[model samples]
Target: MRGAHSTADTAVQAPPHWLRTLALLLICAAYLQGGLVKLFDFGGAVAEMQHFGIAPAEPAAIAVIALELVAPAMIVLGVWRWLAALALAAFTLAATLMANRYWDAPPEARFMLMNAFYEHLGLCGAFLLIVWEDLRARRARRDRAMLAGTKGSALQ
Candidate 1:
């Protein structure tokens, strides 16, 4: 009985390959697409930011554009994902604040603010998905190890 494998021991295997691939794809695509858009039409984005009460449009626009474009690539490659996520999350938070600050503007003028809030939520969701998948995979690996250890001990 000392080395008997418990039910919990068999349940903790790494997550299925497909799930991990799907999660990676979804996060990469969403983040990369947004980054590309910001990078390509940067001037328009700066002008829009000005409309939202952001001052000194040129520098802010340049910084945000760079962060959006580069961070997504870093995150997708799984190199410096945590840092990229942090930067992106911070950017999203700023956008949200900008949006709220202009909430009382004319309906047409508020579109950017609304879009910023939605995009921020989407990025946050993607980050959470990556974290959840990572956790599941780790849990599964632990379970598999536990089962293997139990079985080996029983045979000794």
Candidate 2:
């Protein structure tokens, strides 16, 4: 008898281009807004950065702005997507570390860092998905080559 099949047991397909585009756009929007907010209120942002041990706040603020603005575009365009993801990973890691170091601070202050870390976690997951698809494609090519080699050897 044919066993009952479960949908959950099937391997899920990779997301369509449109879905990836939508997700990338949403993430980019949030990052762009964050950069803009920090840029517009430099004094307050600088103070916060200093409190977080990010010395020379102006440069750090500019780097954050540049990363947010450029990386989002790169990710959305699918141009250098992996590099953008890596840069974002690094940025989030720094933010997380800073938050951990200042764990004794007020709860509200700690929350901000936690939020950054959570967002980073999501981004990292997306990056992994992309990489998995790439590796799967390579594995399929290798399998095809091996099958062809076996068939050719059997004919000899």
Candidate 3:
């Protein structure tokens, strides 16, 4: 029985693709909700932008909403996922720095603001990991194709 398969071995196979899709959905839900809320409450979003001291508040709100919607969708669909991840990562970083300026907050608010800042930093790191994985997969596929091509030509 040295070479025989075990139940644990069978159970150790890779997870189904749907699990990945589900994970992507969960990861994107926040952005999707934010985008939809902003779309429905455009005036409120603009006001928030003005509160943040973003010039051209209306236009900035529109752009932020658009990016929040489109980028997450792209990532979920695996369509230009790297670019989407990069965009979202950059957006998260900027928003964190601007909105979660913990040092400027009063002592009572500083703790919460600091937590939000760190959470956004964690999100940015996740996005970068996604980009890295995507690039690694693409390189692996390209390398496999090249190897196969070389093998085929050699056999000819």
Candidate 4:
């Protein structure tokens, strides 16, 4: 009985590879679209920055577009994913606060802005989960290597 398998354990299964890929793609979808849109329309990007009252609109626009593009790539490729996800989380939170401004919306407009604000906050939470999972995986790998090294030394 000590070595017996549990029914729940047997039933639990990892998702298919394609499904995982699709999920990551969906998470990055908005960022990819925004970056592409901004890259193709420099004037519009600048206008958006200006609309947000960000000084030096062009530089601000360029920086945002760069992060929107770079972070998603790093996340999908598993390269410094924790850092990329953390960056995205911070960016999303900042952008939501700057753009949503639900608290300042008029009575009729408050509902929409409030919804958008919370939706963007949900995105921030997702990005944070990515960061958390990546860091957890890295720590696990480190611990495993250390354990393996100890076992090797014992055998020697």
Candidate 5:
């Protein structure tokens, strides 16, 4: 077994932290812009909520803007990322279903609406993957800690 590679040794390494951070920041840009825009154009944001048939449009607009802002920041900063990802995923799914009702669209508009629906679904999948990655990393860290403790106690 000398000099032989194990499965763990052959596993692919993750990209550098800076690269991962940059990618996450880039992914969050759209959400940051959206939240800022909504905040800046309060009336328009409210109208948009009304257009989506969200009751009490003002409060709904505020809630959505808050989510858009907070969730993306949490994700980018790697703080409670799994929770943020799950929140964004749920928001995206609800928005997609409400906004992209392709079945109700006029024949001429249905294709574009369907495309948008699928695109949002893809975003949902991406967020879910974020949640999965976060959970996996947490579990790995915990396992490593437990392993280290076991070895330390054994050596003592």
Candidate 6:
């Protein structure tokens, strides 16, 4: 039955809260470090933005730094996590497309650029996964709340 109860469902164990927090922190570590490094080295950040052909380099650099910092932190803290993860995913895709022009690289540099490009793409995919998980969890909670208000508490 769709609304049948099961001891197996209630018996399922979740990972420890600390472990979950640590995992989230580890996932966001690189971005947090990059953000802090850019914040401390504004000139270098601006130069990077300029290298990527971003106009008004200073403002672009600032915006990048802010996004890099805030999004990762929000994700780790589970505050608007899906939105934060989606923002990071979009930014990663855009930055990777702009900076990792592997197809245009010389033969000698092509391999390295290609690897970097793909790595950034992987990061974008991971961020999107985080977004999906966050939204799924939110929906699950909403469903549970609704069930609690009605005679629908049985596990599916």
Question: Which tens-of-lDDT digit does each residue in 85-137 have in candidate 5?
Answer: 99999988998899999999999999999999998898888889999999999
> Candidate 2's C-alpha lDDT?
0.73
Ordered by lDDT, highest first, the candidates read: 5, 4, 3, 6, 2, 1
RMSD of candidates 1 onward, in order:
6.5, 5.2, 3.4, 2.4, 2.0, 4.8
Clashing pairs in 6: none
Model 3 spans with C-alpha error above 4 angstroms: 1-14
Q: Write the per-residue lDDT of candidate 4 for residues 57-104, one digit (tens) a residue.
A: 999999999999999999888899989989999999999999989899
lDDT of each: 0.70, 0.73, 0.91, 0.91, 0.92, 0.89
* Each candidate's clash count: 2, 0, 0, 0, 0, 0
- The full ranking of all candidates by TM-score, starting with the best, is 5, 4, 3, 6, 2, 1
What's the TM-score of every candidate structure?
Answer: 0.58, 0.62, 0.88, 0.90, 0.92, 0.86
Per-residue alpha-carbon lDDT of model 1 for 55-109, expressed as tens digits? Answer: 7987877777778678777666666666676677666676766665447768886
* lDDT, candidate 6, 36-91, per-residue tens: 99999999999998888789999999998999899988988899999998998898
- Count of clashes in candidate 2: 0
What TM-score number comes out for model 5?
A: 0.92
Residue pairs whose backbone atoms clash in candidate 1: 12-140, 13-140
Better-scoring candidate (TM-score), 2 or 4? 4
Clashes of 4: 0
Q: Which regions of candidate 6 fall more than 4 Å away from where they truly are?
A: 1-12, 151-156
Residue-level lDDT of model 3, residues 24-141, one tens digit each, is: 7777788899999999999999999999999899999999999999999998889988899999999999999999999999999999999999988988998998899788878998
Q: Residue 1 deviation, candidate 1, in Å? A: 8.4
**lDDT for position 1 in model 6:** 75
User: Top model by lDDT, which number?
Assistant: 5
